[model samples]
Target: MTAGVDTGGRAPGRPRSAHVDEAIIEAVLGLLAEGGSVETLSIEAIAARAGVGKATIYRRWSGKEALLVDAIASLKGPPPEPLGESVREDLIRLLSVGPKKPDERTAQIMSCLVPEVQRSPERYRLYQGLVEPRREVMRQVLRQGISSGELRADLDVEVAVAALTAPVLIQRMLRWHPGLDDESLPARVVDTLLAGLAH
Candidate 1:
């Protein structure tokens, strides 16, 4: 699990409440689902929605952008921990977990947020920072496969990572294609890539 955000200036020994954190995060997502943008979301509005004080939110996050990043990350949770038993199983497992079929609200929020993030470089960087750790998880899995002689030694890990992830992302985030809800998708993707990657 991702560690709790550092409470930079909080008094020593004052533990943050998980309940409050969750409420605040939920409030941000709720606002976004209601068509709130990063620019328009205010600390006061979040605090009011979450039923907490502005000071409570400020103690946890420097600003709304930082808070928004964390809120989005919470939706995905952490990257799956690879089993390390085999590349195919691990890759499939990694891909299989998380929201397979986004709810209507989630889909609506992503539709708006995706373009907004792309248009703002700062937001794009924050989004990249949020996703890179998950990509690193995949990279590590592919590297292990190569080391164990399960994958071709010369396989381009970066390319393979993109190839393996892009379809699911497109379907889930953009809904540009059908069949993201297919339970067998992870295995199918792994198998298709393995045909060329396997040693």
Candidate 2:
């Protein structure tokens, strides 16, 4: 496949191929899913699975954690926008709908990353890179709902965002639940959160 080079136009070298990058990420994800800590993830295992040299992997990532973080960051896409006019509809839409499907790789990485996040505080930067941009989008919609009188004006949108996502994450990662589907999750989350936000 293609190789992954930094494409922010920072350097002049061979353009990284998307195919190679995908393969490397897929390989790293599979290893993490198999269950291992950051220290356990080795360049040899990754190179073997990805069919690339260790030097090549190092060229892209400084270490296993960096590589793993980058791999997780690649799996996510933008979240959906609010469609209906009211807060209830907006909450439901934001919670339940998205433009892309969540896959096993994402689920696995998230499962592993939770523990990593707890052990290392500095990793929030990586987590933010992977998940926060999408959160920002939802925050804007929540602000709009408040402005339109669809939601209570004083509700803390930041806390509200955590309330929306933290439960699903806990259920999936800790309680061993099958995890909520997008369709039903929104309605439940909206009902619960709106109850608290309502005057």
Candidate 3:
């Protein structure tokens, strides 16, 4: 081979950057915070808020629904797999994994989602993909409690999850009352639920 000869001649592949991913996601949240509805949140607006080109977003996401799903999903870090050891401990860890107390700004962002979905229900079914994983995490912890004899074996997983989380959601997402977004709320919810289910 000649010295300085071209090596593999093809241009290096430029994989997408995480920073760009984060910016786009943040832009979605920002637009939601600013009262932008789902139907109105264009790729152009998101690209502008994120300070990236429209092509960059389209390369990563096919449309606004996908982008919204991803952005909402990014609001929190991934939940830890629920270890069977001490359900209380596991619950605490899971609750603490993400943003603990979503404040008014956070609540405002979430509050806008319902009306947005109502605007174009079919286009936003993608949102369901983001919710199932979180539900599964809670269910895992509940199943562990059942197997460990810490909770009633007959407990309904779906109902239990809704009960366990409803208080926080109601206070923070549904209504904006002061002092409702307490960091200790989940720990308290777990305790109250377990107390009722203890055999």
Q: Model 2 clash tally?
A: 3
The 0-to-1 C-alpha lDDT of every candidate, in the order given, reads 0.81, 0.68, 0.72
Cα lDDT over the full model 2: 0.68
Which model, 2 or 3, shows the larger lDDT? Answer: 3
TM-score of each: 0.89, 0.75, 0.82
Over 4 Å off, model 1: 1-4, 196-199
Global Cα lDDT for candidate 1: 0.81
Clashing pairs in 2: 2-19, 2-20, 3-17
Which candidate should be chosen as best, given TM-score against the real structure?
1
Candidate 3 to truth, TM: 0.82
Tens digits of per-residue lDDT, candidate 2, 8-70, equal 332357566667777888888788887766667888999999999987776666667677766
Clashing pairs in 1: none
